[model samples]
Target: MKKKKQEEKEGEEEGRKSMILLSERQMKEIYERAATIGAKEALKFFEAERKKEYKGRADKRLGNTKLLLRNYHMLKDHAEKSVFGRTQMEESALDILESMMSMYDNEVIIESIKRSATRTAVIVSHIETMLGLYEAYCDKSRSREIERRRYEALWDMYIAASTMSPKEIADKQHVSKDTVYADLRIAIEKITALIFGVDGLTVR
Candidate 1:
């Protein structure tokens, strides 16, 4: 009877292993498909938005840095919504986004300074500041991209680790943690495809 029980335990373990493999494969497939669809839709939205260009003037009388910072905050709010889609990101991602927004804010301020300042030294300082901000922005953008990829990877790992339990994985990631866990469900389905074979992962 002990031998029989041992055999039964082994069988259950093997079954679990098989299920894990199958779940991983299925999750990967689903991730790719959803990512592809999301990418295409995001691209379409970006292209449409880009085509609408409007001209604006910077007021020299106003503190350009403050105004630009305000605008940056507004845009950042919109960007966070667009990127995370109601999901809270890790502190790292938020830091990178904030830095990028600050760079943009500084860039606008420097441009205003260049136009308004009469002293040659001040103009040069503004120019230097703008250049520095631009470089910083580029670096931050790259880092943000890396962080985003990491987030996706970690999420997938969590899903696999949790045995495809949507609620469990969400809880681990500190994402939704409530409701029906729709975001996590969609993310797992789409991210699997994205990591495996989907193309055009560019942000829209």
Candidate 2:
């Protein structure tokens, strides 16, 4: 029995070692997203005692681990909100799940996210796991910029615009129908470049 427990401990440590840490920019983005989802307390937790300068990867990892382990509740809230609309599996609630074990915990959360069947869910799973890596790997500001740009260019709402007619779009945008078409083309090209970082897209 002692041998079995020793093996399990070794296995968990090995799993922790395998988890990848997120880039600093990525962590910033995660924080921003967490904030957007009303995770003020979690944000406060992350904000506390942040390293002014991570001397090296070792320094960064240790800092992140301590941050995540201590503030997992915030990540938990963020994850739950990310999948708010989806059916919580009768099998489990994401908020109640632990992320400390790495593989097993991640798999369960990922399954729950998948069952939610939304792009937001997938991103949330990635964010939550990345948070744990810091606790164990570990931005939204840029995303808001991207979204603002997309809306300005496309003149559309991801959730609501699909139901709108071109006339309605023109009316809402306060532009002529022809202008709306032209702007939409430019918008698509701009968005393509922002996402793909290629200038090859042209308005047609």
Q: In TM-score terms, which candidate is top?
A: 2
In order, the Cα lDDT scores of the candidates are 0.40, 0.43
Question: Against the hidden reference, what TM-scores do the models get?
Answer: 0.18, 0.26
What is candidate 1's lDDT per residue for 31-127, written digit by digit as tens? 9999999999999988776543211111111222223323432333333333232233323322332233334456554443333223223223332
Looking at candidate 1, the ten consecutive residues that score lowest on lDDT are 53-62
List candidate 1 stretches off by more than 4 Å.
Answer: 1-22, 54-204
lDDT of 2 by residue, 127-173 (tens): 44433332220013345543443344343422232435556777876
Per lDDT, the best of the predicted structures is: 2
Clashes of each: 8, 11
In terms of TM-score, how similar is model 1 to the real structure? 0.18
**Ten consecutive residues with minimal summed lDDT in candidate 2?**
130-139
Provide the clash count, candidate 1. Answer: 8
RMSD of each: 25.7, 25.8
Could you tell me the TM-score of candidate 2?
0.26
